[model samples]
Target chain A: MSETQQPRAEATVTLTNDVGLHARPAVRLTQTAAKFSSRIELALGNQSEWHDAKSVVKVMRLKAKQGSEVRFRAEGDDADAAIRSIVDLVERHFDG
Target chain B: MSDGTVAIGIVSHSPDVARGAAEMVRQMVGTSVDVGWTGGNADGGLGTDAAQILSVIEQIWTPAGVVMLVDLGGAEMNTEAAIEMLPADRQATVRIANAPIVEGAVTSGTMASTGADLEAVVAAAEEFGG
Candidate 1:
């Protein structure tokens, strides 16, 4: 996605990767999560608790399966840009 | 005393933990293996490594095939050649079907030492859900 098309508003995305959420991919996702000023939280499965995208262990605990919808939400000055990056990453399976 | 049964060997970076893990598996199964800490120590432990795999293959023999389990993938001695070098029966008899290496091995080894089968031990690691 282009910088201009970055999520202009706080947005949520569902991870569509076939492998579900994992470490190597999570590491890549977490790195992307940190790029924007907007804060990010990843909701795995149907759990009510939101986990910080920056925490590796927490992300691994999610154990998201293939087809599992993981939500990524960002809210802040660069929330749009941040969400765009996160979405792009999930789209590419974090380039795993 | 050996019972003409296949023997298990731990090929790891740390000799103590490797031997200990194998012994633990023995206690649980009542089938002790001759543990070999491949290229891991100066303490008179088995020193076969990836480079020495050919030489190591020349050493195993018996009614029970000698099994070599490693703690890592690319670096450890259980390369394709080593696996291929084992005598056909010994090769077939050997069981390296444990962990992927490092974390997988340590986790499985600890429990396998206590009698858990290779598969069960691997499952314990899966409990980590990675």
Candidate 2:
């Protein structure tokens, strides 16, 4: 796997906020995701499917509880920025 | 001004509801893009009026496009009527998204602020369901 050429970048971040990925945090995530040109998505721990990170409904639907691990993935010109933004927000407790 | 063309509007049954939803969108997208809203019936009741929606549409009209988010059944109907009432040229640039009012407003508004065209903003709002 390490020898393969990767077109996308992925990162995992823990939801430490009291409400996890609820309304406010979800909104923040979606808005930030929209700023980047890449196609970004979020997934639960070891989940095979990814949810659209630019939709609040999709983000909230994950119901990722506090302390749950959410993985972020992006592909396109701004993949790095997209992943960085999600990781920064999650690490900052979504600025709650 | 690359990302300053498109405008977003919100329409609901209650004036407060429309205002609050617009505020949520503004918080997410900032004040760069235009966001207009109108709510309530002609008599200030708990229903939507086509004229009210039309006025908001006209207020937010732009060369790029305008995306409208409506609250319920009445809003949907009246919004279609309002769009029909616009001049043919203006009508061509307007779209009513089939999305939850609040969520749609925020998502559409954010995308529009990013300089997305009318179709892309509508797509982002509809992406909420999938």
Candidate 3:
């Protein structure tokens, strides 16, 4: 869904780590996203295909390098928390 | 109540190797899983220790069982000995799969975290490769 049209909370963050969303960061993103009750999805660039935020393999497939922008959307009881946690992790570069 | 009981452990000859692989598995599987690992001998040299393997296993053991992924050679031998040291009941709950250490740990951890039974997790690890 478009950012403005999402039925739940959504947020966008730019990956800043030099390594981008590689193995380590991707793992952290998936782990943090999995903690919430929302059904979250992520998208990159102009691709409309959103991947399951909880799947490491799928997140890795995004190949979103540093400076790439990732959009996260979640719909559930805790959609807001899911968006905030994920945005926080991305902003923190997965605490690297 | 039938979910979230399985766990995985990784054994290698180098602590860094085990730690790196464990981190990857934890990332893919999420922190909800118990993906423990150990490497090298007690003296910190290049060798696998049965005691260390046993200790790692015990840390993540569950009634549903634990699956272990070993790097090879001494690691496999030490892991087998570690399992042998466990009591019969605990022994029955553990399984060592013939799978690549990194790939197997990632696969098993992912499967276990999703609520697959021990047998299914072991099968996924084994099936990960040819």
Candidate 4:
């Protein structure tokens, strides 16, 4: 889907907390992304696997497991801010 | 209560997990289910406020009794705490439980929606529980 879209950057945010990327954080990230219209992909640490951020099911299947760093990229008019917002959210443990 | 045994909702910090569990139940019971969730704040942990949980109960819970599957326990713990502070009436109508928030909710939701009785619902939950 990124084949034709606005500028996008892959920002990697490490899962610093003990909980890992568990369901709570994943749901928050997915919910936050649902607020915008864009193609969002979440990649697990150093893995080629990336799932659509909009689909809560697909993201959960990634099994982000704790301590897994996720690289998020948003493709859209507000891709930059969307990516930053998600990065900040992940950094914050979806609000701990 | 349930046209089946019980109605179950996975009240956790993660909406995806809740929805995932709901998805599983929908497949099992082959019907839609009532659902709710919260968990976005960093320090917020994985629990919604008791007030929010009540809102879900009022808004989503239906004829069959509902089983609340919370994640953690103790004072102020996520879903666990939320379930505790429920009023006498709400508590009477709902059953609070602990298990794999996702898998348990799905199984319970499916069984509950299918008109399974409380014992049968609890049994299904215990059958494939974490």
Cα lDDT listed for each candidate? 0.54, 0.83, 0.82, 0.62
Tens-digit lDDT string for candidate 3 (B3-119): 456888899999999999998876665776788899989898988999989999999998888999999799999999999999888998889988998877876676676666888
Q: After superposition, how far is residue A44 of candidate 3 from its true place, in Å?
A: 1.8
Error of 1 at A74 (Å): 1.8
Give every collision pair in model 3: none
DockQ of every predicted complex = 0.02, 0.33, 0.10, 0.02
TM-score of each: 0.41, 0.82, 0.64, 0.45
Any residue pairs clashing in model 2, and if so which? none
Against the true structure, candidate 3 has what lDDT? 0.82
Residue range B1-130, candidate 1, lDDT tens digits: 1334333445665556665665545442233333344445445554435545434444543354444556655435454556667656655545554454433333333333334344444453343335
Lowest lDDT sum, 10 consecutive residues, model 1 chain A, at: A2-11
Q: What lDDT tens digits, residue by residue, belong to model 4 across residues B1-130?
A: 4253456656656556655766655554344456554433345565456666666666655556667776654212544445566665656656665457766665555445445566656654555542
Off by over 4 Å in 2: A1-7, B1-5
Better of 2 and 3 by TM-score: 2
Q: Per-residue lDDT tens digits of candidate 2, residues B15-115?
A: 89999999987776578678999998988888899998898899889888888888889988999999999999889788988888888887777667666
For model 4, residues A1-96, the per-residue Cα lDDT tens digits are: 455648676688888767765555555665567666678898888888777775544565677766777888888877888888888787787782
Candidate 3 chain B lowest-lDDT run of ten: B107-116
Better of 3 and 4 by lDDT: 3
**Model 3 Cα displacement at B39 (Å)?**
5.4
